[model samples]
Target: MTLVNLATVLSKAKEGKYAVGAFNATDLNTARGIVEAAEQEKSPIILQFAESHSKYISLEQAANMYLDLATRACVPICVHLDHGENFNTIIRAIKLGFTSVMVDASLKPFEENIQNTKEIVKIAQSLGISVEAELGVMNAEDGSGSLDYNTMDDTYTSVQEAKEFVQKTKIDALAIAFGTVHGLYKKEPNLNYERIKAIQNCTDMPLVMHGGSGLSNEEYQQSVANGITKINYYSTMSFEVTNGLRNYLNSNSDAFLFDVDAKTIELVKNNIAEKIQIFGSSNKA
Candidate 1:
């Protein structure tokens, strides 16, 4: 399996040479596309399987499918569990051969988040698995375009809290709140670059940026400069792939639509390859 340790990849990023791509995957095509794009770029990549993905969809089957695809490719790859909340699932991911797992206890109180994350680290560490923990909550928004804290606006995280959390939990990577919200941002995100810099200076671990799908180009560049080693992209790539397939079928329906529609794998791969290139990971692998 191509389950290389994330610590190695993070070390590479620490040198400011090549930033590894971390793509969020929901299904087979998306996972394949991520690995294929990494291979094309000759860069290492982290394939993140989010826990919020429709619940209890056996990781063994998924990891095997994606891991096999990754190993045979020409680049280093890692399987990661994103936003893993439950202990059972985190353990399952480790048992299923995921090299890294994110334990998001951001919504919990400080001490509780620490305990929760520490428990995960303790278990995963013994099993040769890496852990990623989140310090702040990213509020969820609705389709009606409103700040829904009750439903889910923003919860900022402190740089000091981040460092302490990491020290107490011993996680390999830390995802902090720097003003960017999760999912597709409806407005221009006012990312706190200052906070990011502070967190980076405080903690030596690689930083992960959630809600990367809709950030402006300048914001992304700034984030990378400020210490965003891994960016979690889900919404944008998913939309791009789905839209590409739809457009291909509709535009070519009269001619090669049927034949081309059958080529789902290539379509998804090309769609994701476009994203990998745009994210500046094309040749960094």
Candidate 2:
């Protein structure tokens, strides 16, 4: 059982100049894909469930399922709650044994975001769970995965405010909105490398890059080099699974419908393995 806290793995990534991939898993197959990628590449990975997806899988179920897989795996893994908006859900995740939780009150006012995050930090730190909080709102206001980068130009993370936010909240990681949107970009994204470096200098906490799915390999490397220690990935993997399953259904005979799930898992595993390498986490377990 190699289940460890997010701080342990993320701290190592910070020191090693790499980023750990945090994949959002909506079902057991997606979870297995993430874990398999980490195990195969010898990389530490995080499996998380967003608040919106909790309706499909309960906190207890996610914790139990991932804990089981993590304990038996050779690589280090952490179970985390992604975009944790509701306090009740955050409490439930912690009580259910999640090793990390993100308090995403970015949409709220600055003071309110701080107050809400501080509350969660107090509880999470007491139980040795790492807390990650977002400072700026991304382009994805709706639940839809994609976002318009232009609409988010005015909302990039403020370096000075980030220092204060971290100091007040005592979070383990900070997810900054540095020009990247949540879903696939319709046009090429102009990532603010300068802003990332500025924020990186403001705090020593492991920095995170949201919307990591659509960037080029060079962009990913640059982000990691500039101090991104954790990257949340999902949009591309979700597309891969959906596309794979759809193709399988269209081509395969009725007798082979039952095999679609297995095929989708295989496709997800392949995609994540590539992502782990892109994030420079391969062989870092």
Candidate 3:
């Protein structure tokens, strides 16, 4: 029964200098896997449902499942909404008991992004819910689609603008774009640790890293050392789960659907546990 808000866990991460893993849950088994990993590692975790994933599962269904899992978990778990584009959808998620919500207005003009995020922060903060907003646009868009690796430099977050955005919006966390994209990278990414340090110095609060998957272990540690306190990881975890299912199917051609589901849960749990260890959140609970 250690369900908590995003800021609560992030504050601890900021103090400990370890980034918490914010893993996206695509289904019930995936959600279960994330929590199980956290509990096993004794780490605090963020269980998030992305807006684009709505096509696979409704918001209400995900919210209900997340809340139930959080309440029954031993380690601290924050139920969050990832990349909530529409105002109504973000509000709806808050009302449905999400501990944290990310208002992604980065695609709009700077001033407009600030204004949009301010509106949500005003409401979410009052109810003791944490609000996270993105500062710069990612090359791969919101988690999936075309990836323009060539234009990645164009989306690097400006340190000055990041300071102003945090001051204006009063958000609990800031998701800054450096070199990471939302989905798989076409080539090895050249991350901007200096920019991460600069933003951390100015904001003096928790900083979030989107497109957290596909990076090397050293990259993750470097990002955390440079002041990334929350890392949004998904694509790689999803990929690993699919591969695990495929391998199981290959070995047992007559495997039942329930057997595959059980294997998915196990595979997902193992993958997330490995990530939790890599992020240096293990034993941080």
Candidate 4:
């Protein structure tokens, strides 16, 4: 099967009561590992790369690799742009063959965020690409000392606004902050399931949950129960592969960095495969 939109994946996930894993890819090997894991599990997956990650690997390089791999892989795969702020970056992603895109205007005011997101939606629509937009902010709130505290923050989206935005923007999916933060969480995030439910009820679009790394499996399940179909994972997968490779290479300093030995690849692959199973996407292809 070819690359599909976020709607199809999330719709299937909504029926299955599971969240599709959107794994962050930094390099060719990283992308390869993600695709390999999904193939092994027979799970459909979205290969994600944020705007910041573009500095290291341009959209061209990453997209080429993902497109090639997806064509050869045994399962459905979607290349997704995660947390991109501007249209320039987003247009580049669309041009690079990304099947899905996320415009994170949560840091901006409501009206401006909507305008910019709507513009992106227009462009992506012309390209037949799925667009995901965020409504609220998910900041890094570390400790009591941090002023960024938002434990299940009720700055949550109102049902009225959600309906208007989805209708105005024509976005394929909506990502609400809920309680999950971007980086690691200092405390267990108590997601606003009620808000998710209200948002899901507000419109028929797919619901996306960010900050997938820090939440517990039970929390993730609750999110799925509340209509979360797409779960974005970045730090978790990076940590998993890096941690595994670090532990393996520590015993042997002769490890080649350019072309990782088969043993090291196995460790990384195993870690990713485990996450694919954990996210309940196994056998989902």
Candidate 5:
């Protein structure tokens, strides 16, 4: 009953001066952690399964799992397919009941990205599903090789183009690249606050900032103040989960290996709770 679509909640966040945390989860454990943390904090959360995760499971299976959890959850849960590339994948996600889908054709030519995203929006909005599209190029660091077409690694989202894209694509949210990458940053990347402000000024649509995991607290709050309504977080969650298990195994050795699952879940929950608070979504459900 608490399950909801991304647009409604994100729009609320836009007016409220807060940002919803979109956590990418690969398995039931991570999904549970995200939901539990959100419920405990009374924050609206987005549980997303990226297209890369489909390598191990089908879109139908992932969608059903998230839907089942969201239906029984205490707080709003938006099930999303993150960084979906093609029509077939997006169609599969929609058929499987994804509440939101990201059509990431940012690497393609501007006209092509617009056309592809527009096609998705046409279909998704008809089904009451919100669509998110990326405008700028971010280097693919996860070694997925899916973003090899992204030749403009240093390219940032054009403010003028962003206005036109929003007007043309009619997407619910726009993920703009403001100097952040996919994985962990080797150095502290400077976010273009001025660019973000410009884009926000030109468009009323909710803006999203990817590579949210490694940004400083000031950077996060600054993004929200400037008009970012949804922030995508993933690498930090994965890092915390793995680090928690590693520490647990090192301490437990032979006897308590099976208990690592609980510890991992706890770690993930704690990490998400902290992120929720940072995003200022806590108690905003």
Candidate 6:
């Protein structure tokens, strides 16, 4: 019965000055590990199913698994749809009982992004669901062995535009691009802490950070200090699990499939627990 919407936990995070970890789960084992980590750490967490990953697990199937997990959990769990690209997917997520949804139209023109986000906000809010919208484009790993610092400014979220977008869309959270990208960074990322502070000053709501993996501890804490209240992390967790599986298989050539699943669950749980501690959400449940 601890299932709740995104706004509920994020509001507490804003007040407490600690960001909640919003981790993406592609399957039941990963989702279960995330919840177990939260329970062990006594922290509130967001379990996300991204639209891009719907190919591996359908939206309907993920919803059923996540809902079952959330209902039986001891701590608050927000089952969220991450990076929902279109109105149809967002609507389907709502019908499937997602507590929160993100409408990502950041690739569109400013006004178009606003209009698209607003439409979803209007619908989702009426049902007591929290909506999140992205204002700037996050770079994806292009195998360049480093982020193109030259184009960083071009992609960073404008402070003024953020204020307007929040006002118009009335979203519960905002994902702003301040130099982070999807997948592993080829080199150390030059995060824009100042930009985050400027946007926070204007919007005065929970701000979210995507591509939150592979940052140093200082970077993560600094982002929180600058007002990032939710961080979407995935790549590093996936990498760690893959490495763990490789090592396990190398040593145990006769390992059963159930044994592999058990190892994955253990690895995922430990990795998430470490992140919970870094996010300063431990014991905050």
Best TM-score among the predictions, by candidate number: 6
lDDT (Cα, tens digit) per residue for candidate 5, span 63-158: 878889998988888999999997899999999889999999998999999999999999999999999999987754564544432344358899
TM-score of every candidate relative to the true structure? 0.89, 0.95, 0.96, 0.91, 0.94, 0.98
Q: Which candidate, 2 or 4, would have the higher lDDT against the true structure?
A: 2
lDDT of candidate 3 vs native? 0.92
Worst 10 residues of 5 by lDDT: 144-153
lDDT of 3 by residue, 237-285 (tens): 8987898898889999989999988898899999999999999999998
CA lDDT scores, all candidates in order? 0.75, 0.88, 0.92, 0.80, 0.87, 0.94
Please give the distance, in angstroms, between residue 5's alpha carbon in candidate 2 and its true position after superposition.
1.4
Which tens-of-lDDT digit does each residue in 33-79 have in candidate 6?
A: 99999999999999999999988999999999998998999999999
Deviation (Å) of 101 in candidate 2? 0.5
Hey, what RMSD does candidate 2 come out at? Answer: 2.0
Give the better candidate number (3 or 6) by TM-score. Answer: 6
Off by over 4 Å in 4: 141-154, 258-264
Q: Distance (Å) between predicted and true CA of 11, model 5?
A: 0.3
User: How many Å off is the CA of 41 in candidate 4?
Assistant: 1.1
lDDT order of candidates, top first: 6, 3, 2, 5, 4, 1
* Model 1 regions more than 4 Å off: 55-57, 148-154, 254-263, 278-282
List, residue by residue over 177-239, the lDDT tens digit for candidate 4: 677777766665666789888888878778888878867777887888888888888776666
**Model 6 clashing residue pairs (backbone):** none
| Worst 10-residue lDDT window, candidate 1 | 147-156
Candidate with top lDDT is: 6
RMSD (Å) of each candidate, 1 decimal: 3.0, 2.0, 1.9, 2.2, 3.2, 1.0
Which scores better on TM-score, 1 or 5?
A: 5
